[model samples]
Target: MRLLSRPLPAALTIGLVAELLFCWRLTTPHMLVFDEVHYVPAARMLRDLAGPVNIEHPLLGKTLIALGMLIFGDGPLGWRALSTVAATGVVVGVHAMLWQIFRRVRTANIGAVLALLNFTVFIQARIAMLDGFMAAFVVGGLAMLLWAMRSEGGAVWRRWLGGAVLLGLAIGTKWTALPYLGMAGAAFLLVRRRHPDLWPGLPALAGLALLGGAAAATYFATFWPAFLYADQPLTLARLLPFQIDMYHQQTQVLPPHTYQSNWWTWPFDWRPVWYLYEPADGAQRGILMLGNPVVMWGGLVAVIACLIAWARGRDARAGGIALLWIASVAMWALIPKSLGFYYYYYLSSIWLALVIAAAFDHWRDRLRYWDEAFLAASAVLFIHFYPILSAAALRGPQSFHGWMWLKSWI
Candidate 1:
């Protein structure tokens, strides 16, 4: 029988297997990590509110978390399931985006592999947080937007609309997604300005309108608490004020958190927040936080390579996308936000992966040997750090040493 004739490739199969195993391991020590205490509570309150509490963040991620709570009963698995699924979606989205960009199966597979092996993506996915979901939606939206750009058909409007809606969802997931949307808008204007014949202004305007409208409606709908309070004619006036108060609450720096650090320290991978644990139970207690060091450090080289390639115009598409990612990641540095952590570097990882994948794609033909060597090295490093990064069992000093790489990390 040819039923299994076209089985999945080794790389894809391995990646999927790793993701599943990691998910299982991650779910093991499922206590609320980091800001999850805030998000999970907010999600619980969402059901009770007539309007949203006006938290600085949009509601898509919280909504999904709520869904998981509904299904899984608000346990660690229930709260984190959504994040895991979203992380998986990010892997798929990266693959789909690469496929659209390179128009080759191998390129897409490579991109997906790199993303799966990414420490930030892996660590963030297993927790009950909004970053993974935001990354997924933003990357997914980018994939759709790229497809729309490449497509040449009468139904292109549908593709454009899909991209816009996804972009809106991305914003709903995280405010950080706004920069990507702006980039998309800028890219559209540049592309349209250059070739007016290919992309008309009307469609672009319509697409933006649809995106903005959908996003606004979704945002308001998620604020159930605000609406309920606004039900009374007199209380309606206080609705906006209530929302403003919530925003203030999110931005306000309360007491000091052990993990809190300045944005400047993030890029160096300093101050990673401990998200989950089951105590040191001799060994095999399982830890569930921290990104892989190999991928994070190696990305530095890839970032440099991408800059050179983009500067030389050798891989303009790859360069442009990398720049977009960098711009988004750099926003944290530019902002005046008081509280920051290593995980905030998630967007930076996305940029790094794109650049790395682009470099690999560009040099695959010219430097096959180097590509193979780098891939092997990356794999080994990821494996080496897997136990510590994922919080698997380790002896006393070894476990402590794992986190002692930098003074700031401690």
Candidate 2:
């Protein structure tokens, strides 16, 4: 069979298939699972003009969920429909970024496939949460950034402007995306130094100001719902108190969660968080937030290889991905809050998928069957763990025993 090598067709196929997989019986376990309790209710509040819910984080993610719920009745499928779509967007966006930056159709297709198979995204896609939406926008912004670097004059500036807006949307969805925005600005400066002809006479400061201003404006605009509250006037004075509360809410130490883990242990997948585990009428269901071991472990090797390659000879793509992974993990280290979770690695996992794709391209000729074999193994692991990932009913309590390979996973 001839493979689909065209970027749009390939990406769209990946996205559609993923969405179907995610949406299949999406209403199963017919109750709020994991963070759904937090966001879904918050979305309903926004839809019905109730007071702000989950104000610690920004509102766009919940607003999108609310949009879906408003259209469809507020049920499992309704709250999660937007998440399903955004997760699909992440696949397409990453595929576009890979295709545009490397211009290698084979590599880009493999990258998209790897992303779909990776459980970090796969699990999040099935649930109603902010991480999937944030990841989508990050990929979208990066795709735009890469597209801008390859263009000339007005095209370049337009893509940059669009990229800034998307990144701002990401930040509005979750504050964790801020480091990525800063890294994007740094990357812009580096690329501009090399390709001065892209925007010939534009001052670097002026260009940065434009991008920053656009991003800031985009972020502020997402707060329109907050401004429109009946008693709260649409004035800066009212916004300041909400902003202060939001800041304190995020920084203040909260009661400990059983599943919390430090940033150091995330790459190892040492401790998996159980987002939902409920004993129902007939049987028990679960949604264990975990990464596919094959992808997580194999991708780590690829990350090391990319860093080595970048150090030997400056491979801009490899260097940029490595820096992004580092930045995503590093920001958590500096944050005052002591609690962190595995899901915080969502942004870095995109690079991990890229690392696997790069490894495939790097070693395809040397070891013809390795990439294909790795893909097969990844698919098998995903299937083996699907029951837990999707909150599917277990035959018995012992059903989860074998899958918990790590004691910490229990």
Candidate 3:
């Protein structure tokens, strides 16, 4: 229990356990789920020097998936193993960021645990999808930013550059990372403007250059053929057109599936996509797609609480973290993208953890009975939904109903 007294050790232990849990069902039912079909094939093509095809996403995530294929063969487990690792990386990165922000060992530990208990993170971590990787890179970038904010002089420059590099890596994983980069940059600029005497222009320039260089390197490294065929006889005139075409394809409507839903309904959790397993057979045989009702509902309340706290200037750290979380999720709502799903809330889980951590902090000095009761309740909810989240065999419809607290979940 002494480990709990130190945030870093506690976060590391929690991250390791989360990673193990994510990897456990990595190969269940042994088949492609959702977008894995597109990604797996693209990864296979990556192994061969086949001409670059029109893939909507950036190359880093597919590159990571390709790495898994190279190591474990082009199988379900191989493609998904990396996702489990990335998911764990996210948990670890979030822990580091929280510890840095709150400077409280218990708050950081609670944040990591809340992330583990989040059904969305757990389910997505176990699947062969890009969200987990996206989460990792995003959190990694945030952690570096926090480090930069906390450091001094040359150390600050180094951390700032590292944060920029990770931000590029995050963009490589998903385009959504761009908004976060913009937000972080704006925040940095405001901070710099407030204390120009403390900021170094040369270091800031160097960090920006390093970030741009890393992004360019990673971009071409993954898509070397684009550079090689730049002037070839059969080469496409430019990469931009090909990218546009790919974007169109991804955004366009596709064949009806059980979970395909409109973006408007996603926030309400109207329909969640089932990413894996033999659904036709029985409950125990498949992984059900769902988010934790407690976290999801609690997050909504937290969002409101966060706004009020920020308005009152009470607990600025908690309020600021909550605001960052809300901004990240709000991007999805503003985007014109089609077919958003519950898993898209992966980034929102960070905010969810923040809310839960803030709540714990509020109760920390209260009567022990309240604290014990809340902890016990959270544990029960986590255990109750563990089976469906992990794809463990369930009794039948009864099992599906265990976590399907809302009619919308079906």
Candidate 4:
């Protein structure tokens, strides 16, 4: 009973299990999933040091995918290996960050299980996609930030610098994480408000500026390979124009897509993206991106609870998570993009787990094992949907008939 409440042990166990689940049948179907169609080729091009490809997004994610291809020989395994690792890092990072914030084992454990089974991160990691890497590094950056802000007596600056490096990697992976660079500084100030002895004063302004510079430097530095491999020669002068080009591509309108969904629908899991549903290697395989219903739906209550707690008691920890939950989705609404997709909510899905963890942490004495109940429901949904989520074999092409409960999903 006591062991069940220890954070580190559960974190380690959940991290290990998450890695094992992510690794299982990872190379199945032997085909690229959805955006993998775009990113995988770009990764290969980056690996071969050939012409530019998939330039709409930053190069760091594809570069990491390219590194996997370089090491693993540009096959199914190579394309997805690091993505899986990054997703696993997300799982561990979520658990650890929850512990750092709430200092509760049940909260962290529930959050980890919810993250792994949420189906969003699980499928994202299993494919060669930028979201997994972006989510992983941002979570790492935030976790390190929590540590850096709380730590004392030397090495605090080192921790902050480490967090800055990871935040740079996250933004370099995708502009989706760019907002978090600013949000993390805000988190530092919030943490200081909770405990004044830490940073003590208005040093946050200077710290925030330093963090921005460090993260920005690290972000721009990722463009180094482009000079050698891009479609055109890239100079310091050319890079800014190149980024402007990317922003344009990202905002360009396209024909309506079947899987496209709005930002608000994401929290409800109203529409699911079917990344794969083809007969492959003699078995009908399908992969779906859907959030865990328990977490998706339950998180609404947790988020409200967090806001109420913050309003009444100025519970900065819960308030920070509530703000993060809002910011993750609200940022997408503010982005210049003309279209949106369910996968865009992957970051919000992670925040949902965090909010749930915080809510339970806030109500630990009153709520009792509600955390266990939520984790159980999430795990059940994960297993029930495992076949579709993992590209597991189905009887026929019509296999989606059972999984597509909503017309929107169909």
lDDT per residue for candidate 1 within 1-410, as digits (tens), equals 23212223433464465469557765555456667888888677564443444367766687788788898887877788778778877877777777777776656665676777777787877777788888887888888777776566644666766776777777767767777777878777776666565433346676667656765565455444335433332155665675576567657876777777776655556677666444543454434345556556666676777778778856766777677767866788765466776777786776666667777777677767665566677677678767656766666543655556777655
Candidate with more favorable, higher TM-score: 1 or 4? 4
Question: Cα lDDT of all candidates, in order?
Answer: 0.67, 0.81, 0.69, 0.85
Q: Which stretches of candidate 3 lie over 4 Å from their true place?
A: 193-222, 225-237, 250-258, 262-268, 277-284, 362-375, 396-399
Q: What would you estimate as the lDDT of candidate 2?
A: 0.81
- Give me the displacement of residue 243 in model 2, in angstroms: 1.9
Better of 1 and 2 by TM-score: 2
Worst 10 residues of 3 by lDDT: 227-236
Highest lDDT: which candidate? Answer: 4
Collision pairs in model 2: none
Q: Which candidate should be chosen as best, given TM-score against the real structure? A: 4
- TM-scores for every candidate against the unseen true structure: 0.84, 0.95, 0.86, 0.95
Model 2 regions lying over 4 Å from their true place: 1-3, 197-203, 231-234
lDDT of 4 by residue, 90-180 (tens): 8889988988887777778878888888888889878998999999999998888777766764567777888898999999999989899
Model 4 CA deviation exceeding 4 Å by range: 1-6, 200-202
Q: What C-alpha lDDT does candidate 4 achieve relative to the native structure?
A: 0.85
TM-score of 3: 0.86
Comparing candidate 2 with candidate 4, which one achieves the higher TM-score?
Answer: 4
Report the error of model 1 at residue 241, Å.
5.0
Q: Candidate 3 clashing pairs?
A: 284-393, 284-394
Give the CA lDDT, 0 to 100, for residue 268 in model 4: 87
